[model samples]
Target chain A: MIENAFYSQEKHGPYKLFSLGNFELEEGGIIPDCKLAYATHGKLNEKKDNVIIVPTWFSGTSKDYESYIGKGRALDPDEYFIIVINQIGNGLSSSPHNSLPPVSMQSFPKVRIGDDVRAQHRLVTELFGVQEVALVVGGSMGAQQTYEWAVRYPEMVKRAAPIAGTAKNTIHDFLFTQTLIDAITSDPGWNLGEYRSNAEVADGLKRHADIWAVMGFCPEFFNQEKWGLFGVESAEELVEGFLEPFFQMMDPNALLAMAWKWQRGDVSRLADGNLAEALGRIQAKVFVMPIDTDMFFPPTDCEREQQMIPNSELKVIHSLAGHFGLFGGEGPSYHGQIDEHLKALLAVPVSESIVEQ
Target chain B: MIENAFYSQEKHGPYKLFSLGNFELEEGGIIPDCKLAYATHGKLNEKKDNVIIVPTWFSGTSKDYESYIGKGRALDPDEYFIIVINQIGNGLSSSPHNSLPPVSMQSFPKVRIGDDVRAQHRLVTELFGVQEVALVVGGSMGAQQTYEWAVRYPEMVKRAAPIAGTAKNTIHDFLFTQTLIDAITSDPGWNLGEYRSNAEVADGLKRHADIWAVMGFCPEFFNQEKWGLFGVESAEELVEGFLEPFFQMMDPNALLAMAWKWQRGDVSRLADGNLAEALGRIQAKVFVMPIDTDMFFPPTDCEREQQMIPNSELKVIHSLAGHFGLFGGEGPSYHGQIDEHLKALLAVPVSESIVEQ
Candidate 1:
């Protein structure tokens, strides 16, 4: 079995796993015994009306958002029950790293954002007995799932906040995702997804990190040496301390699987390749938050799609951190804005028709 | 010996090579014999006063600028004697693929923008007996050399246009270049710069191409399926027909050499890391042209440095093609703007001090 040190609760947790047996995917793939790891905070009220779902971003586990949750933050565990779910292929969940023979590494089936949303729907509706989600919010790939949840089950998600991601994977996003995957697969030691250790593909991981350094943040983030805030003095140190080592410990196949899903993130396929028609299905109150400096999903790109959703509003987050700003790393400047928006969103009463049910 | 099909004059030329014996690099590297492949158009005036030097961009040879040259275009070879020189390591020049053992592939020394300008300086002054250049112009890595020429030998370059590149490689540019190098190096078949054939590291080249897709152009370029203009229907076709196949023909070690030079493109290093002081040394009338939508060299980024150069003006090229706009690929829309501007610049009378010579 692949080592669990990278994903176990001991390393990055205070989370639990919920076994999702025989999970079927939209793209015609099946995992004999699938599982989703998640973490929750606060209580599910008698009405099951105060539950908020937060999905993890690419390569992130449920616990990665611990700082964003709690008493007075955006998720605000004190006011609402927050469920942070780990998307499949992220090591903590049903990933290639942990699955058995037929479903492991090279044999892992392709998982789509829709498939992840479908599995999370079961966990919320069946296990938690939640009739409606107060909000579904996330960033990057997590934001992809948020859009998926909103369109895939319009009634279940009362409100949605998809940050730094779009309803469909733009061709540019697909290209970026492909490069990330190629970075890993090109590693000779990758051995067609049967690498024995992460060390074997260190060069690939480093390359992947270097790509992130280019696209993950705005040019100002590096030009201004903003990594200095993290106590790293130089660009080389920023890569060494943060990017390189961060990906080095993770499974390359797991990342490739997530990238595959990310590249194919298009809800329009559900509505027969019509983006406007697919977005037309979203009945929930929506907030499309895009980082102003994000290379892949710039504010203009997000605002264009946001205009297609009837009840959606475009909120441009001016951030030097670029896409990574959604993780709240620069400071409370962004998180504070998110908290203010979410508080206002939560303050609005739910529709009486749904509440009566 | 490596095949020269890609660089041979018979295939893509009307060019010649000038060999310099035992050329020594400023950065402590030596090429036993350095050769620069270049092409010239039109006739040299009696005074040799109408000469324009155009350096090739990264991965580009002298012939690649064919579309942008000619009687009525930007360089306007008929009006001005234009010499397009290939940057070292770009197959046509003294590259890893064509050099003999000691300076081939794994043994090729790192080349810099300063070194390229220095070689071109010799070609003009020593070989052509040209005391002063009418203009020094280029884009991308070529643009980097444009800046280098203006600063290093300001007296030689009367005017300069550095398009789609900056005087210093921003941390973002460095990171992007690093990723490109890493992608090629990590390919198992690369065997530490000793690949047998281009097919050996095809995966790496494909990944490099994918990264270019993400950064080389604006999202609008791909979103509108602009590749369709090139007779390609889908993104996959764009990659297969254009990107992948384009890089597959080039030498990986040659690319790595260029990338190393690109990453270290900082004229500021000459002034003890004083960007303003370094840019202040330019005596040439400068036009810093950056593509409005370029991810790596946005107008804001270019404009910042442009402000530091005393005789400089910032020209933002508004094209959806982004950085590729410098290549004049989005039709006459961009090329027209370049022509209009270059015509105006050339119309200015030469400095009396230089004209008297």
Candidate 2:
């Protein structure tokens, strides 16, 4: 007899979903109550001074960074309090997919990194009574959020580790994301972003898969192995393999909303009119690690940021894994280099705390 | 008064349309008796040795390049014969927009650079009785066609100049095109790629405009002189300004079809299945010039070709105009460099004549 495996231990996370009360969404739309999904893996010590902020990547949930959080890893839960907050459109949290009708694009709230960090800040301060974070760690879009936390709440974050991220998006990145989003919404079957099943939007998904496969690997990888990633066959098949499980698991509306958020992403917009000044206000020691093979967010873009933030260091990862190599690989794949840097970052003493001005 | 206002200059062009009895287009669809609209400037010399081929840019018509011809310019009609072939789905050419019913995504024939060059070859040999060309020059997608001409019919093309082009598309290019196509076909009003003028489908067009605006200019251009290419104050306004004219200019079906063709473009797919052999077979002298700020076709990609082709030269255009700078304003643009190159190219003895076989 098959046991009810649906309620497995693996599915249970460190934190549960919290209702933040009635909240106005966007475009003159409203949700009677908004729920924020989050997971915390480390214990908060007496002073609550060892917390670290970890935001979700685009299409990634709080579970995505789990590999880096367990025993002996750089962000080992045994040593620090790690808070992983789910961004608005991540399905488990507030999203268009689970929400009721009037579910048009306009109805979806306009969320930036600042908005995400702000909402997450409320959760940390009100519920956990967390005062300051030791570091904010993330990769890709998550890294963008980490940067946002430092800028938006200078007093709350003591250090930031933004990996494979950008200061201001290059035209190429904007074009890439815009295209991916367009592919999904353009399907006649999409019915104006209303189609939620894989059946209706299969073509769009296939096209989306094709684009993703290319961005997730390096040119050298393509030259050597064609389209195979680890051991996949074709670019289409790779995306298919990934999306088959992912699309079914995800809320399509949440995916759509997150895509909309990604397209509008620009931390430079929040520079209080001056980007350099905003970056300067980042009291946290910033560590910008851009992956060399990451076509989505090139290392040069990170190098550009290294120059802007005064107490920042750039750690370039050399791997053919592209954007995802930051998390999904072995110790040698990225850890050795990252560990070396983290050890150095950990050694640096936290200077001048944010005195309540 | 109207007659005097519009000088009816002698229609000196043999700008005839080629009628295909029963040919398929590039969108997995067929067009019975398809006709390709084209314009020819300059006179075919007695021996037809002064022929120059100019393929149209993406979203551009044969008419857009008309100004570059005539008495002056590098492609002076007074000096050589110039052929401007309208790519399939440019409205005037046989496209889903104007075709009979069943105008959907599956209606277009899958076409690559080989198909385009092959058709142009027939037009040149059978229609114009042109045995050889002095030069084939094109920018962007047009450049891809020019490269195909050199690879497919090495003996026919004496010289080739591909500006802001790549030997093979990078994954980045693939993803961008994939996304653009997705945006066009995803709208519910798209009616499975059948929607012609539906308002819902118009949103896809807006998305396309948003993406297109990002690539059309450099960040410096947007930062320094925000003249608003699409006219609105901000990025959203800019997207609005762009889509307003863009969508109205062509049928959505045609755009989708065109994009499909572009996505399938691969010059290596031509010849006897060996890409290296195809590159080696190009007996024509080649000049591959990539613009420094060209976000779509990066310079490093073009440099890849420099290592492959034997009798080839790589020229880098340092311009802030991005892709368009390959065909832009005054002295520093690609036009100036192209003019100098053309003068040099004109002086080089035809490749066939260089070493009499």
Candidate 3:
């Protein structure tokens, strides 16, 4: 696979690159020279009191979070140091798509959500000389990571904002993700991971897109606005309008790896295998903002999580854009909710001293 | 394709053979010695005012509606005469699967919802000597056929109940149906429509199941039950639980043909000159029941149709079973709603004048 520039100082950084120099993953695997792509904006104040961390979503990179980092928005670089880390298995980070030899499906690693959190921890504490993070904010798979940070290291994370995400994978979400993986794996051109040339699994990719298009919106949205569902005049337009963006720039293997991570995300599997206990460990001031129309991460699921953890508040984003509402723009226009939450978090006073154990 | 026993019943007295003889389709398509594999349990009443028509869902045989045609149910054999017509393209129903020189994908006829209703009309008006249907009821695609009966030949259908169905095809439904067709056609073993002797496309069949499993139920159903999302141990169970039945008995060609009909099932398109005027032509008393939790046919879609029709009632069947709640067996079951509606329809005083029009 061709390497794309994931971060540019002009756009995303003065960044730091961390390499494990061949480290062993928890799930009985080794990634030689395993690299974690990341970027940071603004300076870490004395005592690192104003440091904020935000992880990336599935197939999302550190750069994707840039819009939420800069200016007067949430985690404003001018007010607090913000760390954005590329998720493992995504293109810019270490993943099966770009990994050397042993490239078959069998060689793919089975890292869990805990592993992602652990890896991020190493990058923060060991490499960056950071001991505590004031807040961790994320959405979707990123939210999974934020939850992990709070639960896994209650002493380190003081506050968290997990937006439009879930504590565990829902079967409905899993089925959709699994179908996309199956579509890629079943393609004849997939060659069981033994293709000799640059063969693309066109049909499988298109089939994957077909699954995404249906679940991405409510039936009401399509009925109200028929023009956007599939394309008009010809099916080609429909295919182009929906499927092209997903497939044109995506690496099939990277997609599969992320899907595996998503399916394997089970924070409940930790904390003596009791999920609720693990959530209860979080000392952070928690804010769970689940998108109302996000079929994948419905508000009820978020509300359930909020009810489980102490000092947690549930913010329901009433929007019709479904899962993608977290990436606010003209369609969902969720800037108001995002802005309000950021203001509250910034305004709240931090505790002067940590309670000594 | 193995001969499906469900479609092996006799039609028009003597076992209807596959040669083009006893019946012909309205599309001008000829299937020599065409046979409709159907079953009937109820005896014709003395006045035949107790006749009830139940159409089959997608890929379903006349056998599907058998449970409701027993001795004590609404369509009891001792009281009402029931006609459960085997839809065309269902393997055993004069379909492409078992026909002589079996029809290839390219040669398969394009069947409209109207075609299925017209064929059943022939059986009702000619063989059974029934001038008007006491009640026409069905679910999902079956509901589509019931709606067509009332819309196409209103005078013949006295009352209609279309459950968990839509008046016009939505983009989401069209896309999903299209994916199913694509799964069958794109299978390498398909061999351009001549792979009958080779291995059936198991992968493709599995893909078809993957496409359907999500739409059949809600996220809560899967989450609360701890069903596997994917790659988890429960995935196999989940897949089998949802998809196996649909694929095990379905013929690839027949599946494709039926899917095409589903995709093109837009009654609005029938109004070549004027849309509103067409819906205004219907004379049958209509009841549109949309499953409250159905992702495929949201109740609001049915509400639009209810609003448009001159005389109609919109009912909601609330259940977490999603799209399949129309067939759900337990609490809030459609069976009770159906029974109540049947009683109401039977109670309506029929005007003595036959040719009021």
Which model scores highest in TM-score?
Answer: 1
**Between candidates 1 and 2, which one is better according to TM-score?**
1
Compose the digit string of candidate 3's lDDT tens values, residues B7-124: 4544222233222254444566655556555556668877767788887777766665654555656667787887777677776676666666444344666777877777777777
| Candidate 3 segments exceeding 4 Å error | A1-16, A67-70, A102-106, A196-199, A226-238, A329-332, A350-357, B1-33, B102-106, B197-199, B226-235, B273-276, B329-334, B349-357
Weakest ten-residue segment in model 2 chain A by summed lDDT: A1-10
Error of 1 at A1 (Å): 2.8
Residue B103's lDDT within candidate 2 is: 42
Q: Which of the two candidates, 1 or 3, achieves a greater lDDT against the reference?
A: 1
State in Å the error of residue B158, model 2.
Answer: 1.6
- Per-candidate TM vs. native? 0.96, 0.81, 0.89
Candidate 1 lDDT over residue span B261-315, tens digit each? 9989999977999999989988888888888889888887799999999888887
User: What is the per-residue lDDT of model 3 for residues A190-248, given as tens digits with 9 covering 90 to 100?
Assistant: 66644432236666667777766677656665666634423354444655664555564
Candidate 1 local lDDT, residue B241 = 85
The DockQ-derived docking category for candidate 2 is incorrect
lDDT of 2 by residue, B1-357 (tens): 001111112321335688765665443545676667788887899988999988767676676676466566678889999988877665666666555544423465555666677777877887889988888988888888888888777778888888887656665576567666666665556677655353547776666665566555555444444434324466545455554455544566666666666665666776545666668778888888888767668777787776688788888877766775644643434466777776676677874443322
Ten consecutive residues with minimal summed lDDT in candidate 3 chain A?
A1-10
lDDT of 1 by residue, A165-220 (tens): 98898888888887888787877788898888878988778778778878888888
Q: So what's the TM-score on candidate 1?
A: 0.96
Which number leads on DockQ?
A: 1
Q: Candidate 2 local accuracy as lDDT?
A: 0.68
Among incorrect, acceptable, medium and high, the docking class of model 1 is medium
Off by over 4 Å in 1: A354-357, B229-231, B354-357
